[model samples]
Target: MNTHLLMIEDDHRLAQMVAEYLGHNGLQVAHQADGTSGLAQLQSPDTGSLPDLVILDLMLPDMDGLEVCRRIRALPGPAAQVPVLMLTAKGDPMDRIIGLELGADDYLPKPFEPRELLARIRAILRRRGDGGTPAAGQSLRFGSLEIDRDARTVTVGGQVADLTSYQFDLLVTLAERAGRVLTRDQIMEAVRGRELEAFDRSIDVHMGRIRAAIEADPKSPKRILTVRGVGYVFAKQQE
Candidate 1:
């Protein structure tokens, strides 16, 4: 099945270029000029099934991309959980940080090479297992926390935790090697199937977001601990 991707961008030219490029590479692209229409389409039941992924632009003609991301996360059902890849023209690290915190699966800065964009898209979709087969009955449990690899979900104390697709995988990577201290490079390398792609401190940001979802107290985390000068390690013993 060709992956369906929704591009919510105001730049018609760029959208066209991306659509053509991705279309050639097995993705069906749908264009939306603003966040309002994008959100409306996502919320509308008549739109049929949700897209596999959303390519959201940070600057929109109608609403801020951050607001759109917030609303997307608030939407009902699977629509709220669709992976988002944010696009920004600005060269600010804060934008990437905020976007990830707001539930974006990934981000690509503007003036980016199309090949790199394709690679990133492939990486995200691969991590999400776009159309790949799922491993049966594979789930990791530590105390009340359950990481369901098949369902691509995390549940804490019987309640579902809100984690982005990428974050979920990151957690699994750590959980699989619980009690081991992995440096930023090693962690990224472990997850780098078809190129995990990393920016400085990106993993840290994702870790913070993951902690907020799974940890009882994000400020003083227990599930995933920071080793100060080292990287991070998932606690083998959990409550």
Candidate 2:
């Protein structure tokens, strides 16, 4: 079955181009010009047919794309868990960081190459489907924290962690290499299959989000620790 995608973009010409391009690449695209209607489409009566992924543009006529992304994550059932890739023309790093903090699986700046967009979409889908490069049937446990590799689920103290697809992979990557410090570059390479960009803080933002979900106190994290002037390491033992 072809992957289904919902694009919430206000630019009609751009939307049409993306939809057609993605369509030719084995995706079924549904485009909505406004956030309100796009959200309604996500809440359609046929719950079984929700889009596999959502490509949301930051500029919308009805509402901000960040809000739309939040609403999508707030949706009930499987719809809330749908992967989202944010698109924006903003050059500010904080905008991208905010989008990721709100549960977006990926972010792409506007005026981007359609090929790069396609690659990002494929990477998100691949991670969501296979849990990245981890071995099948693998599981990790530290104190009350449990990670089910094949199932791609994380729970701390018996409570499920609300982690986006990317965050989950990042956690898994760290946990699997517990007790060993990994630089941001290494982490990005392992989780994203790409080198880290210069001064890119996306990984740090994701770590903060993950810590908030699993740590008893995100202010002073216990599971994932920072190494000054280095990188981060997942504690081999959790208290």
Top-scoring candidate (TM-score)? 2
How many residue pairs clash per model?
0, 0
lDDT of 1 at 168: 87
Question: TM-scores of all models?
Answer: 0.94, 0.96
Candidate 1: segments with Cα more than 4 A from true spot: 46-48, 192-199
lDDT of 2 by residue, 50-125 (tens): 9989999988999999999999999988888899999976577888989999999989988899998989999898
lDDT of 1 by residue, 68-150 (tens): 99999999888998899999765688988888889998888897888878888888888888746468998999999999999
Cα error, residue 141 of model 1, in Å, equals 0.9
Q: Evaluate all candidate structures by whole-model CA lDDT and list the values in order.
A: 0.88, 0.90
- Which runs of model 2 end up more than 4 angstroms from their true locations? 130-134
Which one is best on lDDT? 2
